[model samples]
Target: MSTTTAPASATVADAGYGSARRRDPVLIGLWISLVLVAVVWIAPFVFIVFTSLKTTGDVMTTGAFTPPATVHYQNYENAWARGDFSTTFTNSVIITFIKVPLGLFISAMAAYALARMRIIWGKLILLIILFGTMIPFQVMLAPIFTVVNSFGLIDTYPGIILPYLAFGVPYQVFILHGFFSVIPRELSEAARIDGASDITIFRRIFLPASIPVLAALLILDFVNTWNEFAMALVILQDAGMWTLPLGLMSFQGQFSNDYGQLNAAIVMTVLPATIVYLIFQRYFVSGLMSGAVKG
Candidate 1:
């Protein structure tokens, strides 16, 4: 009996070892796939940086992969000076700054009321907002243009900003509604028992807890507004009022295109938001997961 038990124990130990050995190749394959994905994702940005540093002659002569014989930092300098990006950058910043906070606050308030406060037609209101998400921007463009033109908002910052806010609010509201719904009712009830007003509860308790969702929403809204081109193109006729996307369009001439300068400008345009995402990536991920899981 003892000899039979010893062989059985040895076989079990060997089986466990074999299982671990099999998992090793799976882990290795997963890691290799991840590395490949990372390289593919990063390669374009790397090429852009290298191309931006190359001279027009070098860019036209050698492929972007070839290391520059001498780095020409002048491409960036020329692009910055010649491209009128200063105004473009400022316009984007202003639009983003105004839109994000306003959108978040309004959306949060609407979401809170919709989710927490039992009101008539609450479900209908939510349905309407959700339905609006399905409507394509292109469909509304003509009507939006006529309205903006009537208000004399065309060629003005408000023209661009108001539309962005209007369209962005519904999506923000939808996301925040899901988040607000998941907040423990007990917490809000406790606040009320302590004589806190709804506004006070929202500001003190809900807002603080909802920071991650807010951060994620803010990042999404900012990126969307920053990269918006078609609306800006149609609405904004003034060159000085152009955003980065519109400004980049000028790089493509009727007869010729400045690929080097265009690449440089593109790099500059993307850098700020890229840096922002890198910095807040942790919060963004956490916020998204929290909202998704809790909702």
Candidate 2:
């Protein structure tokens, strides 16, 4: 009887092992696919870095995939100097600094009111704001230009910053509205019971709790303002006011199509945002996940 029971247990164990073996192929295949996709995505970035480090002749002759015999560190220096990137970098930083904080503050405040207030036309107000997002930016460009020019804002920092704020507000409001809606009403009520004013309640309760959403918004707004070229190009006509993207374009033209210098300029332009994302990667992921879960 003992011998018979041992054989039956061995048979059960063999069946379980067989089942796991069958599933292993599928799991292995999925892992391989993910790795391949990552490699494909990373390949272009690697190529760009290599191109940025090559000499002009090497960049033109060796192709983007080929490694140069000696890495040319001077390409970066030349690109920075020739592009006048220092001034352009300052301009970009100034615009981003103003745009991000103002955009987030206004949007968050508006969203809070829309989400928490018991106004009769709350849905209609939200609808209008959401509708603004659907309007193509190109359609508003002419009107915006006319308005900015009329205000004597054209070719000025305020000119570009004003339009960016207007365009960015709708999306910012939309995102913050969603976040504000899901925050517990009890928290606000508790603050009110403690004799806190509306502003205090927002500052002490909502703002602290909404950090994940705010962090996500900050990253989004920064990247958008940093990479914005079209509005900057149209609004800032002076070379002195050019941002990094426009400055890089000017640098390319000045270099007589030097590929190494162009690539180097591109790398410089990309580096700040890349570093920012890397530094905040964990917070970004957390924010995104938190927003998704709450939504």
Best by TM-score: 1
- Report the Cα RMSD per candidate: 2.8, 3.0
Question: What is candidate 1's TM-score against the reference?
Answer: 0.91
TM-score of each: 0.91, 0.89
| Tens-digit per-residue lDDT, 1-295, candidate 1 | 9999999999999999999998999999999999999999989988888888887788889987777788877877788778878888888888888887888899989989998888899999999987878887877888989999999999898998888888898988888888888999999999999999999988998889999988898888878888898888888889988998887777544213565676788899998888777777778988877666645
Position 287, candidate 1: lDDT: 86
> Which number leads on lDDT?
2
Candidate 2 error regions (>4 Å): 1-20, 61-63, 292-295
The per-candidate count of clashes, in order, stands at 0, 0
True lDDT of residue 154, candidate 2: 82
What is the alpha-carbon lDDT of model 1 when measured against the actual structure?
0.85
Off by over 4 Å in 1: 1-17, 254-257
lDDT of 2 at 278: 75
The alpha-carbon deviation from the true structure for residue 110 of candidate 1, after best TM-score superposition, in angstroms, is 1.0
Residue 271 lDDT, candidate 1, scale 0-100: 88
